[model samples]
Target: MVDERTRYFRRLRRLRNSARRWSVMGGGLAAAAAVLTPYAGIGLADAAWAAAAGASVALAGWRWRDHKALAALPAPPPPDPALAGQRLVAAVERFPAGRTVVHELRRQRTRYALRGSAVAQAWDRLDRAAGTLSALAGRLTGPGEAAVLEAAVAERWLRDLGQRVASVERAIPLSPVDQRPVLASSHDSLAGQFTEGVTAYERLVAAAAGYVAEDGQPVVDERHPTLTRLIEATDRMRGIAEGLSELRRHPAV
Candidate 1:
């Protein structure tokens, strides 16, 4: 998929081309009218001048709308696949089969990342979570421990994020001319929420790294404060997902 920066630049280039075309056309028409005023009847020259003025006005209006739409769009976040991977590894590390699970998840993530689409990567992460959860079902039933619970929470959040990402991907291409503002707003809001979620996940992962286990059970650290951050992030992501869902339901006309 095209990155936001590339998409924005492409749109800018198109707008510039359009403006140039209109300017050239308007100037040519005005020059033709001026040259013909001496040879042709004044009435015909006046008609040509009016047409030229109309073209100029149309170009101005188009530029104004284009500028507003472009300004309304949110800037894309910088790529941080490394950081995102670190957080994912940290979250996976909280499980007993950390090595195997992390390896598989990383492998899947890498495979999809190589596919060259953000939307695909998001879906791959969700697939990883689903696969992991399926494998953990038998083991989780044996005990009700903090580590197991944490894994479950992380999986759910990953799945939720994936769904939201999918919704955004679908809504993006359906944006109509009249709905540019709403689409831009939704894009901005989703980006902000996704960034916050990633940050929270990173903090949770860091805290999990320092986690201590007693008698094979995970112990909580008062100083680390991981769970609260995770919960907050998950809630925010869920809310954003719902908002995206709403957008999909009432797509821009």
Candidate 2:
């Protein structure tokens, strides 16, 4: 999986690199053509070649923008197999599992020195909550009435979360490195979208908390599923938010 992710990043980097080079080359040629056309005589062949060159330049610029948008996105971290496997186990485990829940609580309590204050904290809580939800989701074995209901709710939440994560991921490519005004506007817009996603996840979490309080049970029920979905959504939002925090911490080249 790590190998696959690395390969993906490598391919994207190569594509962006190629696009940047092409944009520069095309723009240069376009400028050169404009300069030469006046003095070189307006022959039919010259006009045709110039038109082709102009089109190429336009295409290059389009590619450049496309690639740049991708490059600007926050790079996702390589997955930890050990961690993933551990989380999988935790997900199947009963709620309030000492081993799983405590670990996450500690991480949240620490308050790591990261930027994007609200976004960062929100994500940490979401991650911690997700681990327990994973366990609950897994424990709902068989297609019993409760099981089916929980699964449906959990699945819906998961799907919504996936969409929110994708939105933030797409926005990452819009980051601006230079030009303060343009960068600020772009950064705020992208960051705002991310924040909204986070907020949506939080509402879900709150709903989950309400459910657990009403039942006083560790196992997830139909109501629990809605909460579970929100918790999971929070988890993904946190992951993406964490990425944004890191991006802000370390300026891009």
Candidate 3:
């Protein structure tokens, strides 16, 4: 992906070019009108002057707004990648969910100091979670669904899931031969927990679709059965995140 920041700067450049083009056009029009006015008869002269004034105002005003907007946004980030931990930074950018999740994980990794494998593992879980969320979202709003899922509620679930996934991955550490099973168990549990939540979302969506197909759409709120089940599922995932947080804090030696 081109990334949002890159696209943002591209937009600014396009707008700047447009502003420059208009400014040049306005200046030229005003000058042309000014010169023509002197050679015109009384009525024509007045019309030419008005045209010049209008053109000047139009272009000049556009250019002013352009400059103001350009100045309004934060200055472009340091060009390309920064030097410190540049490889890790680049790897973080490769995350499907984007930099925010990875960055936060790294920030929380004060103890483990895990690197390569950590990145690989975290990327995998997060990538799968993102795809799962997208699929769940599509099902939630699919044509046959009884009701649309609220964007705010969906966002809340996503935020909680993503943060928990990151924290869990960050907490998982590399182990020697003996500790491999322990690590495997942790991985399996985390994977299962994630899968369970996804299954829950699918269950809810399918149930809603079937019911709506038969009885038609019903009023949905937090109290709605299907909606409440979703909330319960998401809460289960939140509970897992909390448990993972505690595990990270008191990891076995």
Candidate 4:
């Protein structure tokens, strides 16, 4: 049996479906009435009803066009080596930039959150990368099934990472500079989460590359080094985090 909430959603879905059908039906009837009214030479009252129906049809058409445009927005791209490389580079670039910006923002006695304007750009980039993986899941062929699961896990990791970053911003008090211990801890947590996501994607890419079609052909070319470069980029970001941690612990003169 369906749960009550599920049942409610099901009912809502049905209602929406019915509404769509009626909208179309109403529009068609209106158009037909308008077109055929002239031959019938209907009275003015009937003509007014026909005109109103036609107007309703036009409104429905407009609504349908709007909905179609929204639905037509492209989904994220597949996990191609080129796309991976681009994302990897993008993620790495943002990692340092985010740190720098957040550090500077902390110095200004401003509250930094994941939703903060400064870090939001970085998060958006990271989200786009994750979205690319998600889009690829639907495009994957047989034997590359693991990529789909990995994409799902990656999405979850991103959400957790976002929360961790937000927590870091919140853990510190508003100050001119970010010198709090919790900031470092939160940064470490955020980096760890990022590494987890990257590692999962690496496994996903490897599995996707290894996938053999029913005809015994590899899905991804081993010779292309872009994918390897993408994996290396993620590793480099992980290394950067470690280096940052070390610097924070043993400040250089």
Candidate 5:
């Protein structure tokens, strides 16, 4: 059965086709009327010619105006490699020294290096998934066939990755060493940051999906508020993830 989303897209396509057809039909009818006016009578012929000329001018003007409007619409920005890198760095910084999570992550990292442990493998998968997302985001600027394909692929990948991240985040245990008030606070802060990052990442993924649905055209309706949010969220998520990853690699004694 056709899904609701498929039906919606079909409806949009129909509407666009209908509009174009009507515009052409209207222009053609006006031109025909102008032609018929001259044939009606000699006295009316001059007036008919003038009317025809006016109709032609009006049609041309309308088309020109429509073209200009489309041309004036802004395109979406390209992905920023530097910004993506910075986000990763920021995420890494969120993990402070002497934290239980950091120590645990560090142990896993060592095991992965020595024996390719499952925990290490999971972390590596997450890193790879994040990298895929970043690569997809970078290619979202152009309006070519490749860009459209990339957007679609990215949308699918983001959805899958978001789910995976959520699963991992949920499975993470709270730090067991929160005996001291300071440690407890830090633990809470770290958890909150990670959760926020995941939410932001999901939002970015959703935005990408919407962008693909719109056929990569920058619609003027909301002016792509989602896209703006996506950028901000991406940075936030990257920073948080990077900090956590860094803690895994280099934990405090």
Candidate 6:
């Protein structure tokens, strides 16, 4: 299937072609009209030609306007292994994700970080995952087909899961004596899920790294070895953290 980027560039090429045709047709018509204008009222042909001269000039100018737009819309590189790796790594490097997340946590946001807690452990796991992604970014852009596409997705899931885990961890310590037992259960649930999510994240990364390097063709999404399962597992952990935090705020009587 043609991806959106392919369709988009196709459209631009079509427009560029159209503009070239109009410029040729319009310039010829305008020249004819100019020659005809000298003989206006001499015959019906000259009058009609002069009357439509501006239309031709306008068509010729279409090329100039469209050229600016075409210049602005540069086509993406053709699909290849290097481009694939570049895109995935760029996503990993972008806002609130990957190595950026690791740097932000260490350099700026360490104040709220609870040492040796589930959140802390999750962060450490994320650090390792980021390292794996960094290697993949440099070495394994793609084969942009199948489960390989989900590599960035898995990292994002782990990142989001970390946010939710942090939220729940913060709320856990502040619970009242009566709610400690229930809150502790919720915290343990988060810890378990985080461990599971990170484990799967690493395994999935391992498969992807090996596959592109020398392993073999990866399975498609339905049978993708690890991504879907990791996504679902990470999603569930996020829900647990979010729900636990909400319950702490409005405890049931």
Best by lDDT: 6
lDDT of each: 0.63, 0.60, 0.59, 0.61, 0.54, 0.69
Q: Which lDDT tens digits does candidate 5 get at residues 122-241?
A: 334444444455555654555434544654565455444444444444334443445445554554555454445445545555565556556656767655778889999999999999
Q: Top TM-score: which candidate number? A: 6
Root-mean-square deviation (CA) per prediction: 26.4, 28.3, 23.5, 24.4, 28.1, 26.1
lDDT per residue for candidate 1 within 1-253, as digits (tens), equals 3456767777877876777777677767767777766643578657868687677858856875786687677867765778667777777788879977777766667455435334454455445444544454444433434655765686567546645655665566688878867876775676556545554544544344334223235355543457668988999999999999999999999
What ranking emerges by lDDT with the best candidate at the front? 6, 1, 4, 2, 3, 5
Backbone clashes (count) for model 1: 0
Predicted candidate 3, C-alpha RMSD: 23.5
Residue-wise lDDT of candidate 2 within 1-253, one digit each (tens)? 2354677698688877777777777777777667667674777766865786777777777777777787787777777888777676566554656656666555545444323442465455455555445545444444333643654565456434534444454445575546556645654565465556555555554555555455455555445667789999999999999999999999899
TM-score of each: 0.30, 0.28, 0.29, 0.31, 0.23, 0.39
Residue clash pairs of candidate 6: 85-141
List, residue by residue over 197-237, the lDDT tens digit for candidate 4.
65566566545544432334436555346767899999999
What is the lDDT for 104 in model 5? 56
* Candidates sorted by TM-score, best first: 6, 4, 1, 3, 2, 5
Write down the lDDT that model 1 would get: 0.63
After superposition, candidate 3 runs with Cα above 4 Å error: 39-41, 45-49, 75-253
Error of 5 at 142 (Å): 6.0
Number of backbone collisions per candidate: 0, 6, 0, 2, 10, 1
Q: Quote the lDDT for 235 in model 3.
A: 100
Candidate number with the higher TM-score (2 or 4): 4
lDDT tens digits by residue: candidate 6, 8-114: 77777776787777777767776886776663344677767755666756865776677668768767766776777767666777766586665664534542454
lDDT of 3 by residue, 129-168 (tens): 4444445544454453334444335434644554555466
